[model samples]
Target chain A: MHIPDGFINVPTVVVTSAVSAGAIAYGVSRANRRLGEKHVPLMGVMAAFIFAAQMLNFPVAGGTSGHVLGAALAAILLGPWVGVLIMACVFIVQCLIFQDGGLTALGANILNMGIIACFVGYYLYQGVVSFWGERRRSQLVAAFLGAWLSIVAAAAATAIELAVSGTSPLAVALPAMAGVHVLIGIGEGLVTAAVISLVMTTRADLLQLERV
Target chain B: MRYSFLDQFSDLDSFIHRLDPRTKLVSCLAFILAIVLTPPGRWQVFLGYFSLLLILIIISKVPVFYVLKRSLVILPFVVLVSLFIPFFKEGEVAGSYNLWLWQVSVTYTGLAILGNVVTKAWLCVLGLILLSATTGITDLLKGLEGLGIPRVIVLILSFMYRYIFVVVDEAMWMRQAWHSRSFGNKGLRQIKTLGNIIGSLFVRSYERGERVYVAMLARGFDGKVRTLHSLTFRKADFYCGGLWFILLVVTGVFLW
Candidate 1:
């Protein structure tokens, strides 16, 4: 979730911003190595795709709709570094251009949505796929688990940040944030799994090339 | 199809719109920092911050109703996130509730904090809306670059701004195709169709990326992106920054 400004205190903001800056710097260098002159523009396109995909709402059960968060999807489709970079880019644009997120809390948003979601979701997907043997079914299962867990994890991290900021005690914030997100995670899992399955069926080669 | 851009009013001529984007960008950040850093329950300070943003909204001539409406998007989320704070935060119990196995008590201090958080977030969003509504995304990115953000990130954002609508249109076409083909699909079938749309969208995007790269290469593209430095700080920018600084200092003094 996008943490608006004032939700977390000033010290939390400073610390998270520093961490986000480091992670983004590392992500950019890593992406540079992965992407050559011929592939430089691909990152921007992928970021755009993620942003557009996020705007598309699909029907979940009970007539409710949810859109793609695209972190797990990005990491699985691209490498983790590229995934993180794309996510960071998207968040920055959302904050500065769209005002969808707060400028002061941009670091917290990136940390939660970009770094944590991409890395944890990517590694978890890889672990599940490897352990279960990569197949169409395994791809679906891994995508589902990765997306689901990543969202819950980000929510948990946000709760901790809030607690640390003394906005709310961890005991209260953790369960509340986690409970809502656990349901949100299911939506995330379904969308991520469906897309990954379709991609696996069509452009299996792309996934193979990007697989870490 | 025509899509309305996010910064539709950015091209409008106004004092706020004409100011250097870098100045606006930094000032906006400063405004937000000032809002967030204010101690909770500082009602006067919050009001001061709100008035400052309201003045900017008026000067920007971006239509106060539009900014207010857009800023309301954050309210649901803020309420959802902080709704339980009063109940869970342990302090002087303002009220107590008994619901089966749980006893929930809300504290006045917690309620005050929650109110403070919501007000601060709303004000911060208003400030940001003022910034973005006045400055184009391209100029915003340029301002960020001039402020020392890395080049790679800026390039990525510039392209994202340019092509986000393109991808959206592509996704919209796919949705139209799906809606037109499947009359009454629901449940798993609907998700599957949506998945197909997203999957195909990704492939299309990937191919487009390749095509764009090749097109760039055809023009003797290099890794480094260069842009014209057309942004110049005016006396107004300095005055604007100074005015904000003075207002913020006054608020800080009031806090003290």
Candidate 2:
């Protein structure tokens, strides 16, 4: 869901950039107050981990594979605010270093993959876990659903941005982007659930870390 | 192990590479904005932007083929998203075809938009390639910090660049180990194994982060990051940056 330049117009870029910048600023301040000196190396390493994890692809079907977006997993492990910062860092590095995303479209890409994905996944996972009383099975199921919905939501947001930009009509971009992501989201969900389960078994204390 | 792949051509000496990274960074953004903000269907403007990037690439001493190959990274995505625009757009139909139970038609407007999008995206990508290829990653991060991006963000970026390869190597070794141990099992079991790999990676990275923090503290580290060298803007930066800005304005105004 990395929207390259020209896929959206100038106004869309301006609006999304403003929104993402505000969210990131708020996240940064919150993290500064809450985390102090420890957050720097930790967040940086987390961002690197997410970036490296994205490169590790798992086979999805016949001759096709998908990789984890890592937003939900990040949020599930860390808090939403730190998740935002980590994802934004990953997106920035990807855009500047690798050109995996366009410079002009950086705002929209961060808005979709960083902010939207993290918040949606985090809130959904929290809601599910809270409602289900945080049993191991419930937490795993919540993680799966949260990861799945996060991808779909991010894809939907991209489609909406494209439609508003006059690049494609909503009727077409909406279903197409969301439909493809639904399958990809399944892979994301499975990986997230398994990873959480692994964490739960090994370092359960990590899961109990205070969400910033 | 090949860590320099991210900015492979940045070490080469040239006018483009020698200019302040801030200069190259601003110029690249200006070029991309010009390409993206141009009105659709303006082939002349698009061609002008393409040639501008080509000249820069030539000056930077980066291989044209390398830039072209890197630019193609966006092609599959562009094609995937815009492939249906030609069918869904409402305009004077250029051609009509019958496929099973449905009649599909391609419109000239749709084709034109598709071409414009692909062209614009290509130009912007080439501009980015020019910036990244000419500027080393460390220099680029320093440039970003010089440009008044937040200090913590810059620090995070530097750390990410420093350790991304380390984590990547670890992940690759784990993948090799997995392949060696497991049969070609497919389905939930495979996903579970992959998850274990990722989970283990996260744990290792997190612990390494703690170790690094402790190491930094041992060296009398504060929250502030200090670098040995600082960037200085030269006369060439002003001349080149001014020239690039003027060219962008002239092209945007005259062509529009």
B144-210 per-residue lDDT for model 2 (tens digits):
9888889889888888888898999999999889888878878999999999999999999999998
lDDT of 2 by residue, A26-108 (tens): 99999989988888898989999999899888777789778899998998899999999999999898888778878878999
Candidate 1, residue A107: lDDT: 89
Candidate 1: regions farther than 4 A off: A61-63, B1-3, B98-101
lDDT score for residue B191 of model 2 = 93
When candidate 2 is compared with the true two-chain complex, its DockQ is 0.79
- Kindly give the stretch of ten consecutive residues in candidate 2 chain A with the minimal lDDT sum: A57-66
In candidate 2, the second chain superimposes onto the true chain B with a TM-score of: 0.95
Model 2 RMSD vs true structure:
1.2
For model 1, residues B76-102, the per-residue Cα lDDT tens digits are: 667776666765555688998887888
Q: Report per-prediction Cα RMSD to one decimal.
A: 1.7, 1.2
In terms of lDDT, the poorest run of 10 residues in model 2 chain B is: B80-89
DockQ of each: 0.72, 0.79
Which 10-residue window in model 1 chain A sums to the lowest lDDT? A31-40
TM-score per candidate:
0.96, 0.98
> Which candidate has the top score in lDDT?
2
lDDT of 1 by residue, A41-151 (tens): 788888999988888787776787788788988998887778888888888888876777777788889899888998889999999989999778987999999999889
**Consecutive 10-residue window with the lowest summed lDDT within model 1 chain B:** B82-91
